[model samples]
Target: MGILANTVSFRQYQVLGDPPAGDPGEWAGPLLAKNAFVPIDSGSEEISSGWVCLDDPQNGSFAERRDFFRPPSLAFTLRRDQRRVPAALLRRHLQKAEEEFLAAHPGLHRVPKDKREELRDTVKGALLARTLPTPSFFDAVWDLERGLLTFTGTSPNIAEIFEGLFRQTFEGLRLVVLHPFARARALLPAKLQPLLEEQNRAATDAVLEQIQENTWLGADFLHWLLAHSVAGRNSFRVRRAGPALMDEAFVAFLDNRLVLAAGPQRVTVAGPQDHYSEARIALDAGKEIAEAGIFMEKGEDAWKTTLKAETFLFGSFKAPGVKPEKDGITDEKSEREAIFYERMHVLAEGLQLFDSLLLAFLEERLAADWPKRREQLQRLLGFEEQ
Candidate 1:
């Protein structure tokens, strides 16, 4: 992995134990870190993935810590979206569907009128169902920091424990809206660089040592799942093998591709579609929804798309937790998009501020190269080099 490259999910967890020691610097606990991390592509798809750290190392350790990767909860689904459609349009669609229904069942016309009326009600409901537009989402978050570990979590409790731990560990802490992998990479100066590298290495070594002593813990989890999750020629249950499945999931979480749903339902990306725009290029940028049948949709809202030249949010991964709510489109006159940019500017500013502080702590080592380094990264803080 490059300096900014990542191979694990560094999720913002509600650290359950202690609080930060001094300044209460806060930071989020990454996901898929057990801490192991996997890498992924820009579109939240799996590219190259692996274990950054395993509960049990190759050498034996906790009965193999294996996570059972299950598909999205889509099988037993109930439409929960609340957007309503115009009653008139619904009636129109229902009437057209009834005509087709009656033509298909000439014998039904001969039945009692009351019985037909009841059947019509049932048919109309199915026919009148309208599509709900996809939702628009934005990032909303806040935080404070302490010493040792950065305590950042969406919840108050997560932040509290994060603070406590840093207080105890005197490591450092961080709390903010965005994921810190890339940001954390940016924080390391020559002096403190070794600090983070040491922590990462220390964690890895401890895991390996534990495994060597407690051997059964190494692959026990994998074996248990292998004998159970895979049966009958790699059927629909699990599309990939045990190790590969876990590896991919870790990659997905790290990449923010794993979305948590409310119930047990299966979700799969609609295979593919075609599209053309102004001839600069003709291609497909679409996503599909498939249950008993398939529903095709296009546009940026479809399939979490981004134009090639767009300054894509780099918010590539889909993390599990709360799904963002969808509000109707804002009128251009409202300057909604501009307002949004302003808010994000504020957040990006706060993170950048902390970035400066993090660098200051290591100033002694980076003093020689700080000038050039700052010039290169100034764009991150809305500045340009002279």
Candidate 2:
């Protein structure tokens, strides 16, 4: 099954190796069960079987692990469960009961610490036995032919567990997290390679500084683009090394909605009608973009995705204009291989566009330019200066 937009966030991995021989329908279940989680009956933490078919073939039955083979790809759900007793609540109840016991037996002195600890354990055990487990679900798709696996998840812990489980389930397959650094390392030009490689050699926050530098550029570029779009200016030009000129395309329009968060708790979201003004208000109120649904056409293909500003992560990418073709393909394997590589190439291009736009923003605009531009945006949107 393919990743569905709106609900899940995902990261792509370059799966390495040919598809395992034998019918996936027959061996998939055995592989999944090999590393499946076992739920403890009465423990504070219990992890359930994390691997299962995404769509249950049988109604209310897990025998549907056989349904994982959906032609060229295998899709499944990774789930984990955690059960815990609230320590504070249990302790509070134990303390109240201890006080009652002391009051009843006024002849006895203070209860021994060891006996009190015993009571505490009893209370904790009772609570643990009664509490229900919290469950987490993630979607995973394994493209058998192209050696590409896309995990529909975002959390690092879940990702770690997923990687371990995946390796255990399918021996020799390793998942390299395609984080920004990893992507940059894989795709950045040779000249800038040293900057990334030597970033962490000296422990002066260089690696983090590099990341922040890029992140700031990305945010400022988005901010600058929004300002220019509001003012009806879209074209941009970049000066490359020597006399060469590089065409810069960072045009993006706010799509359906914008999501902004002031801090950890407050989020102000608005839809398309007067969305720019809503965004200005949120910005003026000291909010950072949590997610911005944007439509961007930088070069060959237009991209529609929700951009998470904090991490510069794109989600639910819609690349309709760039479709892979299998024009001369005769066999199913060849066709699948062509489509997979094409999709990967398009994704790589999108990432390259992202890097180029941020570089352009940093080079073409200075830090001193932001305040004036920000004021102009606020004034245009009719928001009072803070």
Each candidate's number of clashing pairs is: 63, 0
**Residue 177 in model 2: lDDT:** 54
Model 2: per-residue Cα lDDT over 26-67, one tens digit each = 777677756555555556543454675554311122345335
Best by lDDT: 2
lDDT of 1 by residue, 97-149 (tens): 66776788787765356755766566544433433322211111222221111
Each candidate's lDDT (Cα)? 0.27, 0.59
Candidate 1 residue 177 Cα shift, in angstroms, is 12
For TM-score, the strongest prediction is: 2
Give the Å shift of residue 148 in candidate 2. Answer: 4.3
Which residue pairs show collisions in model 2? none
